[model samples]
Target: MHISAREREIINLLLDHPDGINVQEIAESLNVSSRTVQRELKGVESIASAHSLFLKKVLGVGMYIEGTPEQKNELQIAILKSGQEFTQKERQELILCSLLKEPESIKLSSLANDLHVTVATVSNDLNKVEEWLKDFDLNLIRKKGYGIALLGSERKKRKALGHLIAQQLNEYEFLSVVEDEYESKTRFSNGLLEIIKLEKLTMIGKMIRDIEQQLPYSLADSAFMTFTIHLSLAIERIIQGEVIQIDQEVLEELSISKEFIIASQIVIELEEVFQVNIPIAEKGYITMHLLGARQRQEKNDWQKESSTEMVVGSKKLINYVSKELEINFEEDQALFEGLITHIEPAIYRIQKKLDANNPLAGQIQEDYPAMFKIIQEGLSEAFPKIVFPTEEIAYLVLHFGSSQVIYDNSKEVRALVLCSSGIGSSKMLASRIKKEIKEITEIEVSSLANLRNIQIDQYDIILSTVEMPGFSKKYITVNPLLPKKEAEQIRDEIKRNSLTTEATLLRKLHNKKFKKQIKLKTPKLIKQNLEVIQQYTETVLHILNTFETISLPFIPTSSILLLEVCKQANVRGLIGDYFEVTNQLTEREKKGGLGIPGTSIALYHCRSEYVMQPVFLSFLLHEPMVVKAMDHSSIKINTLLLLLAPVDMQTGQLEVLSTISSTIIDDEESTRIFTSNNYTDIYSKLSYALYDNLQKRFKD
Candidate 1:
């Protein structure tokens, strides 16, 4: 019997506690949620059955193992002697690897036997595998007795194959294979490795490296590795007599391009090395890959691109998003450049029907649904003829999201950001690290290909978006978007390292001269610290004082209600002109919904030159008004939370205003207080929230 690592750990816990243990106790012990423990229990039950034992549950008592001591000991011994087995997810991937590589129908029983699982288990795995294939536009064909086959165009089949390999191996592992390490094969099992022989991978890698200098621009590490694997797989398929075809018209058009010439050269070399007759159509596909490949360019090199349409499209996108959000990004040059770099290849990928997979798509969508929708709308308006997938849209969101704010801090430590391609994710990750971590003074981004050439001692720390295999130096692997949990983790790690460095320095300076130097600067440091604290306190007070709840008379329409709020702000000197601010707010509303979902409140927020400072005001309506919710659904709202900030504001002030936005939808209690339209309750909530933030900023 095969059991996962988590299942073994769970069984061990149950064995230790022969007595009943509640689900909560199990969850606490494992450092997992109750839901995670509950989900694992279903798998745990199967292990118990295999060991001739049963789990006993009693009302209000919890669960315990019911079996003889001998049976328990035998099961424990088996677990101790057992090696790591294939997880259900790994098994499913192996199944996909087999199906994508196989050109003929494969039997269900054959798959079951190879995986050391039952036919029923394989069938269940196939159900999930089918859904995964659908993302590549491939279909799984299963018959009762005739067996199963995967049906798709050769182009899609190859796309699916490449994605599977990319998904299975991290950058480090992928590079290891290309370097002829073959270490990945030890863990990946036979099916995936059988797709391309190790020797072929090494040869392809060497050939690509030899020809790297011939190209007009250098390929990013991700693009280089992807192209290498693609060529290796194409050679393998060609050897097996699986020929692919390309459109003649497209081929004829591509033949005159520079990429086509390079593609032809690559095919000639491959034909010589593999001793196979390469077809003209193969060169056409290679040209497409080359056309869509991401090339490493300087940060300001976006203007160098030959495509004028791409530059115009990028400007239109930025203008659309700027108008909709009521923020000025027309002059954000970094944003314009990043969009040019991302959108150019994005358009080619879409035109070629390529799968631009984004692992962070779900997280990005969940975290910023409003921004996601806005970007989606902007894409439609900017590139009307092209239909971008969610994956590509998510990547574009990262580019815009990163450019939304700017952070300036007095950082002392230098860090390097190593991403797959130094493009969308790298820019976002670097921005987030600098924004959140004050100690990080400077950030430099590099592709994985440049890792070897980087001066390690120049950087105090190394941060990577992908895993680095065979790397001896210390590096923290972080997600591109920098989720909250990972941000905290990065903070803790930086702190720990800082303490170590400081301790060493203190030891080295354990003398009278060092002590005298520190004492000399004590008064100056104290005065500087006092000023910072006073500024923080003043900012906090200003934000809290500006926060107010006003009860407005009945307004029959949304537009009139907005004007009333703007007029109130103008009368209170919050804004210089109510008409201009109202116009800005109206434009924002037309772009997307501002209503908070699952509540009777709407949040109208904007950054405008008309606003004097950051303001958080609540307006209670005598009658509920119908508005659009964040999810694009109609909602009835009785409260309006107007959050405003100056067009040019300090990062600290922006943070406080952003905090208010978070607090409105933070949880049930805070949302309830805002929705209740109670002045004292809301004031207390903001006070507590700001207090917590102030503590972090002034923790020194």
Candidate 2:
């Protein structure tokens, strides 16, 4: 007969009150919700029945165990021998939570009395708790006669509390609790929810979701959870008269950030909702969290100065890792973009001393020890002043590991990776599927916040690493590692749903239930399919018809070269105004290097109002000219590809233009043909590529 800590607490409480005890009293005694107490009572009744005792309850009254003294004594003995039913780690966490919640010193004897343990055991646990505090720059104080107290600034204390709460739940559980999707009755989760005030949490989560639209980029799930908790704790502590302090100087520095404006708006709303005046320092702290938060997608308005630094640092890191592993990664455009996106916010967190808190760092270390070591070395060499924690390094390894996964476009199926998984975990899972699952040729990652906006039918299958409580679309849940059994299950799923199988097609055609419907819809379906094909064909023909290679006079500088290309575009009736298009391209080029590294080409691209439509043109330089490459290194380029699209371009048109850009560098044969300066070969190659893409779309 195993008794949980809560159940044992209930029995002890009932024994003390032999007259009667109600659910409210038991809940208050255990510091849990009344609902939680009611749920735990089911197991308590079973325990009582096993002990030869009956729990009696009367309407509008109370309940108690009706049994002999010997039987009650037997139940007490079982509880005593059960030893409180808490592991060492659980006990330690509970003790830490107690210390964090208290403002003054707490005696060892008092802690032991509450946990049903001895003072000596608590004293030992305090040693480990003290070590954990040091990570947050906090200290534990103890004296001979006085009790123990945590010593730290209020800001550090709040940070420690938020981090402790986050550690108690994984990403899915945290989001579920915040969204009120379901109720989980675990001890830690329920306790933390109670402490934070669950109603307030739900309100704060909603407020943040409403405000997310004003943000430039989407917040990752982990970051969203962390920020929500931080705000909730801030409000709770503010009402309790325990306010944190930040230096005016530091606050002033933070006030210059774009996040500071958004934070101010949030604080204004908080003041209205809670009817309390939040301090200015609270807004500053909020800005700091926003600055240190991770984003799922890239923002176009990212600061140019910081982006330049990230570009330089990322290229160095990639070069170092590639050299150490003897693998060429410089040409991997996806890897380059991914590293920049991840490293930008990561450096912010590192500078702010915020922990990455990755859940899979240990597993990643075990799975790819060599790759981990090389990236660690690369980080140290690339950014000497910053120390990369194992957690951050593990995430970087996932990015590199994903870049190594070869995606075969010949495979037909597409999968969408939905969250409460973070970007790192999602990419690792996507990489696993690409490696083990032969049918999935493409994978798209999206967060739960953006799930409603996604075109659900575009993907052949949806894969998630978390439980979706009310999701309408059917999605398969798998572990991030995608073990062998899950791989086989995915294969079976794809096979069963496959439309290409002859037997399945025959069955669908011959089934009596569908014959009438198919006969009636065949004409309409044919018309719709024809319209779709025509739309795609029009885009393809427009791009190929406008694709031309021209020889340019000597242009010494990139600025002049861009002007010359725009002039040629004007002459070819591609743009309404050549000067406006030139300015747009030059402004974009100023943001970063447009040249593709290790190649004799520079990709100049822009979206402008002056452009008539999507256009792609190859310009051959009279002489090789020096240009800054994507890696910020000086390189000589003889060919420049200008890709332009209107601001209001359609999706299919933009995709067609993108296909043309990809064809230039997607393979060696395409790259050679584009750089060969042979107009006949270049035109034929692009026409065939576009035609093939259109044919594939029709087939699908």
Model 1: per-residue Cα lDDT over 1-700, one tens digit each: 6677778767877876788876766776666666777889988898898889998886334788889987887787777556656557768988988888888999999998877789999999999999998888899999988899999988788888887766656566667777776432443345667887777888898888888788877875666767887888799888988888888899999899999989999999999989999889889988887888866466655687548888888999999877665456787888888888888887887898756655457767765565677789999999999998987899887787666331111124667887543432354467667667777767777656557777665565788765554455557666554667777767776665542232122222243236677667688877876666665577679877777899999898999999999999888877888898898888666654677667898888766789877777899999999998644678999999887767665545655664565566566798899998899999999999888877876775
Summarize candidate 2's per-residue lDDT along 381-401 as a digit string, tens digits.
888888887878998988876
Clashing pairs in 1: none
Residue 244 CA displacement from its true place in model 2, Å: 1.6
* Highest lDDT against the true fold, candidate: 1
User: All candidates: CA RMSD in angstroms?
Assistant: 21.8, 29.6
RMSD in Å for candidate 1, one decimal? Answer: 21.8
Query: Who wins the TM-score comparison?
Result: 1
Residue 410, model 2, lDDT:
14
Off by over 4 Å in 2: 1-84, 185-191, 294-306, 355-357, 406-700
C-alpha lDDT (0 to 100) for residue 21 of candidate 2:
74
Model 1 per-residue lDDT at 167: 68
Clashing pairs in 2: none
TM-score of each: 0.50, 0.48
Clashes of 2: 0
Clashes of each: 0, 0
